[model samples]
Target: MTNMMIYNELTAICGENNVFIDEPMSHHTLTKIGGKADVFVTPQTYEQVADVVRLNANYHLPFMLLGNGSNMIVKDGGVRGLVMYMSHLSSVRVEGTQLTAQGGAGIIHAAQIALEHSLTGLEFACGIPGSVGGAMVMNAGAYGGEVKDVIDHVKAVTPTGDLVILNKEDLALDYRTSIIGKKHYIVLEAVFKLEKGDAAEIKEKMADLTYRRESKQPLEYPSVGSVFKRPPGYFAGKLIQDSGLQGKGVGGAEVSTKHAGFIVNKNNATAADYIATIDMVRETVKQTFGVELELEAKIVGEDLTETAD
Candidate 1:
């Protein structure tokens, strides 16, 4: 579709405040990186988002459903479709021991809401940076707990743009993957099952987790958390450190001096720099350890330069 047509149709479907033409993708991402999208939409409600999706599908135009941009990297060339930010979809409610939360809600927010009601089980999500949809889609976990442990059911929009509900068993949750990919469902809301617990104890666990994160991670720097996935029997950081690659980088993107697993922006790094650093890490680790290092975070869009220094 033409730019004018895309704008006209989107504006007609959603109000002016809900859409942007050629929105800069960097501002929407957690890594403070990347380029721009042809168009961006922040639908005011789930129905509005669904309407946008249905309309796009009808036209056969490209569209990408975005969460918090926690687990993705939009490339320097940007995305070639309508990028939707679901932050405004956030809502949370409690029904007895179950918490029903919108996908846009962060897991930490859910954990806090659970803590307020003295609900346990979400204490493991204390510092997870992704949204509930992000956490659910990837089964995001930390400190020995995962989404599969508490999720009950999910309401979502399927690939064909129809809404559907799936029980916990249907998600096929595993290490950082879900049925959302195979089933192509865009999560709208999720219900979590939790047990009653002491509010003080729950807070204590969250605090402890927060302390550990602050002390161990290079939180002061801009990064995407762990850059590489753990190999079968070896941690990504340990292998990187053993291979003598800590603090190495391409341009301003460097493997953090404080933590080997993090590739950080040391001096205004670009998306190219980040990509270069990642490539070097992958190649170097494979050469040194004889094991391929897989990326935990998703890299999207296209590199403006085929070769970035």
Candidate 2:
């Protein structure tokens, strides 16, 4: 299918206002880096998302599902085909002690809702910037709490554009990964189970976690949160610090001085610079401790042929 034909079809479905051509990815990601996407799509409903997925399949065009782009880095060469942003679908509701949230709802927003209802389980996610769907896909967690602990089930559209409900057990949530992510399913909504708790205590706990995050993380700079996953026996940040890689940088990308786990855009950094900085840290850590540091932040799109600074 030709580009014009696909564009016309997508416009017919979501309207021209929802579709963008050559959209800059830098504007979407937290790192403020990356090139452009050939086609950017924003679907406001679950049916729209399913339709978009089916359209991409029919056109033989590849598509990427994106949330708020918190833990992802798009490369300098950008992305081909469709890049769907799900933020417009955000909606949250509560019933009794259960909370159901649309995929695009921010984790922080969901946590706040839980707080308002005196729900106790989601306080740990109060500081997460990712959408609830993204958190479910990655089993995102912090402060000794994980999404898997409270997730009751999730509704998602498969890559083939079929919507299905999966229980928490079927999700196979582990440290930073899930069946949804592995299968490239587009999450529509998630149901979380929580207990009624003292609102005051929940607020206090959320406040403490937020303070720790802000004080330890390089929140002032643009970054994709933690760059590397925690190795089995050691923390990524401590290892990087031990390797003498603190404050090291390539171009405008720097290993955060405040926290070695983060690679921050201290200056106006390119995607290439961020990638190079990650590589440098990985290699240094590998040589110093004989540990292969895997990345927590997923890299997507294409790379540009440019000299690294």
- Per-model TM values vs. the true structure: 0.96, 0.97
- After aligning candidate 2 to the native by TM-score, how far in Å is the CA of 212 from where it should be? 0.6
In lDDT terms, how accurate is model 2?
A: 0.92
User: Candidate 2, clashing residue pairs?
Assistant: none
Summed backbone clashes in each candidate are 0, 0
Best by TM-score: 2
Question: After superposing candidate 2, which stretches have Cα over 4 Å from the reference?
Answer: 306-309
lDDT of 1 at 23: 84
Count residue pairs with overlapping backbones in model 1: 0
Error of 2 at 246 (Å): 0.9
Report lDDT (Cα) of residue 159, candidate 2. Answer: 84
The best candidate in terms of lDDT: 2
lDDT, model 2, position 140: 95
